[model samples]
Target: MAATDDFSKDNILGEGWTGTVYKGVLPDGSILAVKQLWRSSQSGKGLQAKMETLGRVKYW
Candidate 1:
């Protein structure tokens, strides 16, 4: 998908080696953090680690 201007620097919430995270407000008035993954790090092992970490999370 194409990123719009609305999700620009002004809407960025944080940034790291992984990617830049943006704060977005949905139509239901819910706020969400959208993490734009780094293309270079989109490997199978990284994805597996992410899944494992998510599975190990006991709470939000």
Candidate 2:
């Protein structure tokens, strides 16, 4: 994705049990963070629900 420049290694911000976090930028020049979730049995709708429940998260 353009946001993460195809998830380039240089853009990696951090990693966690669930996935890796990447630094991203939007076309408007807004900076954001994205998480690339690890593959698991829980995917598609199941994964969507899990993410929705998370709402906004803060991690250092």
Candidate 3:
């Protein structure tokens, strides 16, 4: 299987050391960006830790 044409370079939104970000439209016309993360970078502060930190943030 392959990704849709919507995931091509023409729809590129931005990029980072982790992955290339792409802008995509669903069949329902909703817009969204897809991120492809690098497997080697999923350590250190993981998702649960990040979420816990975010949960502690006090908004003004």
Q: Pick the candidate with the highest lDDT.
A: 2
Taking the tens digit of each residue's C-alpha lDDT, what string does model 3 give over 1-60? 023364687877788776776776777876655665556465667755754764676634
lDDT of each: 0.68, 0.86, 0.63
In model 3, the worst 10-residue window by lDDT is 1-10
Task: Give the higher-lDDT candidate: 2 or 3.
Answer: 2
TM-score of 1: 0.61
Colliding residue pairs in candidate 2:
none
All candidates: CA RMSD in angstroms? 4.0, 3.4, 6.1
Better of 1 and 2 by lDDT: 2
TM-score, each model? 0.61, 0.68, 0.59
Runs of candidate 1 exceeding 4 Å displacement: 1-5, 51-60
User: What is the Cα-based lDDT of residue 13 in candidate 1?
Assistant: 79
How much is 25 displaced in model 2, in angstroms?
0.3
lDDT of 2 at 50: 67
lDDT of 2 by residue, 34-58 (tens): 8898877766897788688756666
Better of 1 and 3 by TM-score: 1
